[model samples]
Each structure stands twice: as structure tokens, then as C-alpha cells.
Target: MGKLREVEILLNQTQKVRFERAMERLQSLSSTTNNSVIVADSIPFNHDEAFLKGHGTSLVDGELLTTVCGVVNHVDKLVYVRTLRARYKPEVGDIVLLRYSFVAQRQSRWRVDLNSTQDGLLKLSSMNMPDAVQKRNTSVDELNMRNILAEDDVVCAQVGESQRDGSLLARSNKYGKLHKGQLLKVDPYLVRRSNLHFHFIESLGIDLILVRNGFIWVGEHTQSNDPMVVDDEIISSKTRQSILRIGNAIRVLSTLGFTLTLAVIMETFDLSNMENVQIHDMLGSEFHVWSQRGKLKEEHVHSKKNVKALI
Candidate 1:
């Protein structure tokens, strides 16, 4: 069966009970707009008038409400649904990736960028210390922001209580510290905010970060002289662009059955139309192509002077 057909079958199977309940509820209510599904039997405006915040409006066949100028259209199927609730929650015990941005010794509070618009505070008292270490007596200001969290060193921290306003607070060394990891980001609109945990890249064996801010990142943990080499300089423009185009296209087609695979021609070096192009050349050319397509009128083609080639 087709993918969409399979999806429809799955949706129907999962939502059968809920669908029946919604239809029954709709039949009992008096709605101004027709929100019912259009089945084979009767066309009674059907729709579940309940408005769920992030979730979509529940509608079945045969419900009625408002139609522009009295024209009526039956509900065939629901195209989308909203997440029921959120999965990720900030608490005192949880370890989180943190970025420190400000430090004020006099105030005895430090600021952290916890993937939120406003920075969170970290009180000095939260620092965990052994009794022996505390007795050594070191200078207080010695714990400078730069020393603790140089500009962008990612750290792990724990959530703390706010002083007055509702701004969040956190502390590292209180729980533990984060060293290195990858980050992955997904469109927030495409995911249910409450289901943040589901977006994690655990299956990929990489740390998944769902910053409260929309950005997410995923990085593989590498430790070796020859850790997974990513050639930064040698790729050609045309090849680079082709890779990105193919990647994006593959991503868009993921929900469908489209898959990219190396053909037999690629295994054997039959470099006919496929000239030896560098990664840089492919990337630059692809970028240029996109840039040219974006402009209203044709302009000069982008220069590929510094771009390198990749085998």
C-alpha cells in the first residue's frame, strides 16, 4: 500500500474510539458552524467544537457551523493534530547543558544562558564543596565568569529557585559539569513543545539538546588522533551544493519512501560526466546557484577562486 494510505490506516486505527466519541458528542450538540465529517450516510455538519490550545480542533463528518455566504463543504479527514502535553521539565535534580554569560561577585550571583531569552542566576552558596576544601580559604572573586565558563564553554548545571521575579536560576559544580557533545535542532512548530524529550538524538548514540530557545544541536563524541575526519577545505563547489541539495531533498522526502543510495556506476570510477570535483567547488556552486535563483534579475555568477575540491 502507499505510504499515505498506510498513514491513514494507522491514524484511523489509533483514533477510532476517539473519533466515534467526537462524532457522538457533535451529534448531541447544536453548533453554529458545520464541523462534522462527510461519510457515506447523511451530511449533518459535524465537528468537535472544543478548542485545544496547541492541538487542532476536533472535527468529524456531518457537523455544521459557518460557511462563507451559505456554501457548505463536508469534512473529509483531519490533516493534523496537536501534542497533548510537554515531556521536558526543568527541576532541581536534572543535569542540563548551560552557558554562563555574566558574573557579579559583589552580588554573589552569576548569570547563565539556559536556552532562554532571559539569563538565569546562580547563587555562590550553591557551590558544592568538601569541608576540607572550604577551610583552605581561597579568594572569592577568583571564581570569575571567564575562569568558570569561558565565553562559550558548554557546562552542565542544576536548576535553582528565583529570588523575586519569575526568571529561572541554575548552578554548575552543584550537580556536575558538561564537557563535549553534539546538538540537534528541529522546527519547534513541527514538534509539540511538551514533547521535547522525544526530539532527543539518543537513538543516534549522540547527546540531544533541546534548548528552550528554538535552536537544538547534536554532536558525536569523538576522542582520537584520527577522530571522524570532516574535510573542511578540499570539497568542490558543485559537489558541495549537490550534497546539500540531495540532503535537503532527502530530508523533505523522509516521511515519504524516497531514499538515496550509491549506484553501481558510483562504485566503479566511471568519471564520465562526473568530473573530479572538490567539496568546496560543489558547495560554492550550489550556494551560487541558490543565490542566483533568489535574485529578481540575473547578476554576475559567484566567483569560485578560493574554493577547494574533495575526492
Candidate 2:
């Protein structure tokens, strides 16, 4: 777990011991090397071979040194440090959750806050028109950009490349303005990039978008449509409860610094139901401890299976 200061205060003596043991087990299971370093620390390098320093590293005093605090990584001849607490770094093809900040007239793009250092650009050309027609965006369309996605609307989009000037280009069809949903923010590192970011829970009829930028959206499942077109279907009370339950599962996993995955989320949901724990009570200290213990037990069983297979 990254920073459990808030969680630590809520745990009792036995819970604290159990939590510590689970964290120790997790740390032992991590594949990351012991090459963690801080700023200005000289990184041991191969002097004989030419090595390229990547992000979070700098050349100083004829030695390669780290410029950020993180674990060291190596790829071929390149060495880089993966910073632990930096803002989201947009990568091409990453799914991100953003809030529409404002429309930028200079570039004819909509500025969206992605919880990153630089706001991303959702260009008029990137979005699908209201009529689902693919054509050139005229000046009239540019004028009506606000009507398509107004200021303060939260959207899900895929990262296109950075423009010449360094602004990120965002494009999407399935992703656009989100509605009738709850947006939850978590540490970006917790979200592992995978083939599918969009998940439709068939049983609950809820849509879950696990953005690479650490924004999770839980809402009633709906077909992709233009933001201007609204869905008239009403969400049932049962579906609403399911959505909240899933959202709370995400929150608990995030708080525990567990990796967010569809399997893990579904396990948490199933655990809640099996234990007869209400959605509201999932956030309680006891349930948090219990959840961690459950995870630890699962991991132990998985490790035993791996060992047996090797034997």
C-alpha cells in the first residue's frame, strides 16, 4: 500500500498486524527490483557500453544520476526510472477520463482537464458528429462545439499523439460525455493498462470504464452515442444499487492500494454479497480489514498452486 496513514488510524491492534503481514506478502511478491533510488543519486551504470538514459534520469558530473524518486527500469540499452508520484503521463492509445474545461478558439479544440500537467485537446475533427456522419467539420460545426460538449462535462477518450506544440490529441467514438454515472478518482498507477478499458457487467447492466488515467466511471449501460443525443431509458432502482456497490468496491480497492482489475473488482463484489455486507458498510474499518485478509488468503492459495505446477 502506498500511503495508509488514514487507514492506519481506523484499524485496531489485530487488524494492524494482519494488514502489515498482508502488505509484507504483497511486497515480497512484487517483481520490481531493489534498484529504487531518489533524486541526485548516482545510478550504477555500465561504463563499457553506451547506454541511453531515459525519463527520470539525468547526466551530471560525468555520471548517470536519478532526477526523481522511483524504481529503476531497463529496456535494451535504455535505462529509466518509473516515478511513483508524478501526474498522469499521456501515452498514445491510452484511455483517459477528463472533464471538459473550455473551448479553445485558437486551435478550434475543446480543452479537457485530464488531471495531468497539460490539458488534452479534443479537436472538432476527432469527435463523431451528432448525426453520426463522418465528414469535414465546417465553421458552423466549430461554432456549435459547445453544444456538442459544453464546459464541465466529464468525458472518456483515447489519447491520440501529442501535437507539434506538445498538447495531447484525444479521439473517441465509444467515449464522449458521460451521464447518469459516478466518477471516481484513484492513483493512476493502480490502473493497469489492458486490452479492454470498457467493461459492461451483464448481470448488473452497468458500464465500467477503467481509464488509464485512474478515473473510473460506473453507470447504466448504454450504447455509444453523440453527447448531444440523450438516452430516454430510465435506470431501475436495482441497477442503481448495483452501480453503487461496484463503485464502492473500486473505492475500497483503491484505498487499499490494490491493483484495479476486472477480476479483482468482481471478487470484491462477490465477497460483499457472500458476507452479507451492505454497500454502505463496505467502507467501514472492519470490512476493509476483512477484505485485505481475503485478498491475502487468495494470494496464498495462488502461490501454492504456482509452486505445485513448477514441481
Candidate 3:
């Protein structure tokens, strides 16, 4: 939705009306109470019951207030707001796709950037070595740490632990150094937590990783045992094109501020292919508007089915 003024000017009268209607439908689906707030606003709450303050909330002279602009959430007696745009908050066992912004040995651990508030720590002993041995890291291995993961390397790993000092612990195996792929960044809030993040579209020969930190990686499919192994052979043109098409579809969905899920992403890709929209054309303003219209139509059909079942 960023910088869409230019795109809006390109729309004709009918398209504009359709776009507005689709957006209105989307808004209607969202919880009005959940999403209506800004920073410094007093959150409406029951005064009779004792409430525990959580993240994005502050107490000011007995009044509960929000510290960030986002949707309000409550769990039992606890209340908090989930921020729409903020740095990634790592959780234990959450898979993350990260680019090594900088890597240096500090106190015998490798500190790497993960696009979070602080760099994550990857202790030498915690990583899966090339030999796949389980032993303490020797001084020689410490000297050769660069051979494992050098600077600026894009990698995937699971969040092991979060330290009291705010640093994160990263552990890796097949989710290590990435290659033969494209990395995309999106808002962390858009990606919903799920049991499975790694997906292989066998028909397209594409691997899609939806990292919890909002880093998405699309690459050629590889065996799970050796995910980081880079094949010297060239990727097929069809596979590359499919990957690009899927990635662009994801981009368009994210731009529309839609909640990103595997189902929605696949549907978008299928819609584009069914419409014979080229990969490049999928990024155009017209295609975006069309995609929204398509989504609205799909939702309308689904709602009608529900109504039929109810009757």
C-alpha cells in the first residue's frame, strides 16, 4: 500500500470503484475494536477487573495506555498490542532467514545480524560442522570459523534461546548457509506462525521458506539432508521463471497488506498462471488491481457457500 498514489491515478472510473469496494470488504472483515488505536491513546478496558500489562502497553497514573500504534490483544487478564511495524522479536524454535550483516568472533562465539534489535549469537560449539561431529570446538576450529559461515552469507537457522541481555542464540543444520535462491524481506507481522515453514513445490521444483522473521527464500529444490549443497548445474529456465512468478505474487500480496499464508500465496500464483499474466506483468499496477478483484470474488463465492450451508 506504500506509494500507491501513482497507481491510483492510472485506474479508470469502474476500476476505482471496484478497488474501493474490495478494500471496504477487507476492512469489514477486520475487527474494528482490535485495530483502532495509536500511540499515547488510552486503551478501553474494564476498570473492575485487575489487568496485567503486556508488551506495547504502559501505565500512566492508573490509566492503561498503548505505547505503539497497532492492534490490541488480550489473553485472560493480560493485555497487549501486537505492533504492525516493528523489529522482529525472536522466539525459541522459530525458524529465521537471515543475512549475515557482520560476523566476528567475540568471546569465542560468532555474532551475526538477523535484522532484529540485536545481533544473534552462534556459538562455535552449537553449529553443525561439515563433518557432522558432536564434540567441543577446538582452537583450530575457532581459527577456521570463517570457512563455516563467512561475512555477508545468507543463512537460515532456528532461534535457540534469547539471553537476558537481549541477544539471541542461533542454531543451524540443514537450515544453514543458503544458495541458489532469492531472498525477500517483508513485514514480520504478515507471516503467521505455523507448524511447517519449509515447503517444496514439486511440480515447479521450487523451495519456499517462510521464515518467522519475515525473510522469505525461494530457491531450486534440494534434498533435505543436504539443503546447503550448491549444485554446479544450471537451474532450468522453467523452474527459475516459476520461482520469480511465485516470489512476485508474494510481493503483490504483501503490498496489499494481506495476511501471508501458504494457501493464499499458492492461490495468487495459480491465479496469475490461469490468467496468463507474465511474471513481470504481475508487478504492474493493473495486475495488482485485478488480483485484488479476483480475491474479492473468491471471498464472495466462499461467503455464499457458507450462507447456503446455513440455510
Report, for every candidate in turn, its global Cα lDDT versus the true structure.
0.34, 0.73, 0.70
- Per-prediction TM-score to the true structure, in the order listed: 0.34, 0.72, 0.71
lDDT of 1 by residue, 1-311 (tens): 00111233454322443344334334433254443322222223224543221123233343322211111332444232222112234444334455556675445555665554356566545543322133332456445434544555454444545433313333222232333342322222222223232122222223333333333333332222222222244444544444333333222222121111121111111121244433334333343233223331112233222221111
Model 1 worst lDDT run, 10 consecutive residues? 260-269
* Top-TM-score candidate index: 2
Rank the models by lDDT, top first: 2, 3, 1
Name every residue pair that clashes in candidate 2: none
TM-score of 1: 0.34
Task: Give the number of the best model, judged by lDDT.
Answer: 2
Model 3 clashing residue pairs (backbone): none
lDDT of 3 at 147: 74
Q: Which stretches of candidate 3 lie over 4 Å from their true place?
A: 1-35, 38-69, 72-82, 105-107, 165-173, 296-311
Model 2: per-residue Cα lDDT over 193-262, one tens digit each: 6777877777677888887787888888776556546787888899989889989998887777677777
- Model 3 lDDT at residue 121: 75
C-alpha RMSD between model 1 and the true structure: 16.0
lDDT of model 3 at position 168? 38
